[model samples]
Structure formats: structure tokens, C-alpha cells
Target: MVRRLSIWAVGLVIAACAQAPAVPPQASAQETPIAEYGFGVLADLAGTRWRGEPGEADKEHGQPADYSEWDWDLGGSVLVNRHVLEDGSYGGVTYVQLSRKPGVLDYVYITSANFRTSGTMTLNADGSWTAEEDVKGLPHILKVRSTGRRHADGTMSGVSEFLGDDGEWTPGHSFTYSQTTAPLPDLVPSGSPPE
Candidate 1:
């Protein structure tokens, strides 16, 4: 009888150890979706003035120049606060911001043009996000459709495209915003945020 009781006790211990712990249903209910984050860069193509190639400058002097034929490159990332939306979706707006510093080429010349921007991100239930910003009297908008998953270490990667008013498509600008926990320092002044 003593041996039988000992075996029963061991079996009970094993069974208890094998059973999964009870996870509260509400815990899952309150869980937020995986968040996303990233950075971006933008070039003011409209402000670009193309002085023809070095030798061609002399050939095209004093002529009505064409500023419309210039190249601009814009890129950036977003740091999403929450990965999912409130409606059981995969994303939502959290406490995160997008920032940009001017490129080397943008600063070399003494042009009155300034390169700066600031904006917020909103993740949609359908795995999409919209980034909106107003900078230097121009409005910038980006719409992203997530095409990837969040990793175990809390990182997500996805592609995004830029949209413009007047229903026209801008060329040569695309981005991939990644989510990270790394802290970013404030580059702007005390009362204002950097663009």
C-alpha cells in the first residue's frame, strides 16, 4: 500500500507539470498588435535647379532654364507604437514620430531652401498605415501596406509608397519602415520638434 501511494503521488505530480498553465482570456483581449517603426529621407525635387553638365553650361547660358527636369530622392522610416489596431487588427497609432536631417548635398550650396519635416503615423486594421506631414509649405503623404510579420524580438519590416495630390504619381521614391525600441535623441529645440 505504501509503494502504491508513492507511485500515485508521483503520477499526480507529473500530470500537473505536464498541464499548461491557465492563460486569462482577458489577457489576450487586451493585447495590442505587433508595433512597427522606421525612418525616412525626402528630397525637394521641385526646388532642384539643374545647371547643365559642366561643359554644357557654356552651351546653354542665359536661356530660360527648365527646373522641372530635376531628380529627387526621399526615404524614411516609422517607429510604430503598437503592432495591431484596436479592432483586433495588426496595427494602430501609438506615441511615435518621424524625423529627417538634410542630406550632405542639400546643404553644400547656399540656397534658401530648407530640408525638414515632422509627422505622425496611423496603423490600420487591415495592416496598412498612413503617414502625413506638412513641411516648408508643402504637404507630404505616405500610405503603407504591410507585407511582413513581427519578429519575436519586436521588429517588423514592410514597404511603403508615397502619394501626391492632383492624382498624379511621383517617380523614384520608395521606402521600408522598420520597428525598433532604440531611443532617439531630440534634435530640435525645447519647445519644438525636429522634422
Candidate 2:
């Protein structure tokens, strides 16, 4: 009698469970967002904007300061960077994508000055990144190498060197950038687009 009663109770519970309404599982509120591009090496750069004034060397040469905006686009598949100089002298857009090889990124830069560069960038072990690029439209500059690192104080610093015709790597530009809320100004604003 005891066994029969236990089985009957189990059957009732099973029937009740079977008759209950089904509920889809809900996502956890505490769940973290997955970093896109798998490696997430450049995650910190997304949704950030920066401003860098020309260095003393550049100031002495009348180079204008520049502003940069970085963001993830194309459903987080590509990292886009747009920059413009203060005096409207130059501006460019850069697209960064994951290369065929893991842990490497390929970038293409096109500027208003009709210069273009294609490069591969790698993240260093010390939390810095380095880029090696081939420059087009500049006869004197054959290649460009650059490195950037973010500081703890929320600023960034980078140095670029140009490979000249003489095969010497000369200093190109050095920048110390601070985070900014400003947008990149138009390089050549002519008005609204034709409808």
C-alpha cells in the first residue's frame, strides 16, 4: 500500500508538470557582452574620441592639431577611425579589420591629401600596438611604422616613423592625445548632399 501511494503521488506530480505552461529561458541581466572580432584586442578603442595637439616639432613647422573619432561599425565587424586637422588641412578615414591570421589586424587609410596606406597592426605584449604600412601617393615616403599605447591617466601617446627613399627611418609625427567629447570636423564642408 505504501509503494502504491508513493507511485501515485509521483504520477500526479508528473502530470501536473506536463500540464504546466512552458516558459522560455530568459537571458541573465548580469551576462556580459561578448567582445566582437573574437579577440577583443581593440575593444577599448571603440566608442572613443581623442584630440591630439601637434608636438613642438610640428608646431614649429606650422602643423595643425588633429581630432580623431573611433568606433565599431558594420555590426561590430569593422573598426572605423575618422580624423581631421584643426586648420582643415588634412583628414582621413581608416578601416581596421581582423586579418586572415589570428591576432593581427589589417588597416587601410585614405586621406584628403590623396595619400593612402595599407598596413597590418599587431598588439604588443606590453599593451601597446604597432603598425607597419606601405604608403602610396608619397614619393619620398615608402613605408611608415607607428606605435601607440594608452596611459593609465586615460591619455594616449604614439610615435610614427617614415621610411624615406634613403632607407632611413626618420621621425614622422608624435602625438599625446586626451579623450574628448568633440566630433571630428568636416575636412571640406560644401553643404548638404543633393537629394
Candidate 3:
């Protein structure tokens, strides 16, 4: 009986694998360029909040506790990132703005994290972005850098690293952002009042 059950389990596993598709559903639709690149790309990104899921490295760091949500608000010409970790114990907010500069081919991003660390980056042709900046008040001069990319899954993902005065980049933690659900609109009776 045990041998027979094992054979059945093997068959089930094979069937499941065969049923899986090559690409995830909606990949082609979402990843395709919806509009010309540049500041225009921010249109679909604006008025929306993307939430991040902590990776294994982040979890191992004893962070990203519940009640700590990573949300990036891309509205107006600026991007506001709010994070609450350990129920508001230790978390910092960041503000990032993207624009054009003289002789710059890509949109330059200026970021201020908790008013401490300041950085700049640009969107790359590969649909990825990177930033580099310094933290004002630390034990030592600290330079931080991060790289992230957006995917058709409607998520922006990245990792961050700390550059100590020694100029060594400590392995950083992973971060990502996914769209937050929009609220339903309120209804009002119109045309003719219901009886």
C-alpha cells in the first residue's frame, strides 16, 4: 500500500509541473511599454502606492516586522516613501524627486531619507534605477547606494548597501514595492430618485 501511494504522489507532481505555463499570466501585457519613456513613465506611477515585501536577507536582519509597511507614494513631481517597522519602533521615511539636468540623458533623482541621508540617481534604459548619497549625521561619513527595477508584475524591487568611510559596501537589504488597492467611489442617486 505504501509503494502504491508513493507512485500516485509522483504522478501528481509530474502532472502539476506539466500544467504550469512558461510565463506568468499578464506578463506580456504589463511589461510592454505603455507609453514613451522619460518623465511620462511617471504618469502610470503617480497617484499610486507600491508596497514592498522583505526578502530573506531582510528577515534575517530582524526587521520588517508586522505593522511595518513599506509604501512608496509617487505623486506630483516627488516620490514619498513611508516605512513603519516593529510597529513604529525603528523606521525612516524618504522623499525622492526625479527630473532632467543639464547634459544628462536620464532623469536625475534626488532623495532625502529622514532628512539625514541625501542621494541622487537616474532611470536606466534597462528599466532599472540607482542612487548614491551620503548620510549627514553618523558616527562616520556614510555613503549609501541602492539599485532597483520595475517589473510587469507591477512591483518595483531593489536592494540597498551602506558605504562606510572605509569605502566598503556592506551587503544591503532587499526591498520591493507593489501597488496598493484603490478605494471604491461613493455613489449618489441621480437622474430620478428611486421610489
Tens-digit per-residue lDDT, 1-195, candidate 1: 110111111111111112122334444412421132222111122122111111132123321111111122232221222111111211112222332321101111111122232343332223333344323322442221112222334322222233445454333112112222233221222222111
lDDT, candidate 2, 18-132, per-residue tens: 1111222452212321122343546556776777765687667665667777778899888777777666556667777877664467778776655577877755444565678
- TM-score of candidate 2 to 2 decimals: 0.74
Question: Which candidate has the top score in lDDT?
Answer: 2
Candidate 3 segments exceeding 4 Å error:
1-38, 65-77, 98-115, 182-195
RMSD of 3: 17.9
TM-score of each: 0.24, 0.74, 0.56
Tens-digit per-residue lDDT, 1-195, candidate 3: 110111111111111111112333454523432223233333344344333456676556444421112223444554443333322333344454544441111222121111255554544434554456666544433665666666565555666666667877676556554455533122222222111
- Ranking of candidates on lDDT, top first: 2, 3, 1
Clashing pairs in 3: 51-178, 52-176, 68-84
Query: Best TM-score goes to which candidate?
Result: 2
Instruction: Indicate the TM-score of model 1.
Output: 0.24
Off by over 4 Å in 1: 1-113, 126-128, 137-155, 163-167, 171-195
Stretches > 4 Å off in candidate 2: 1-39, 189-195
Q: Quick one: RMSD of model 1? A: 25.9
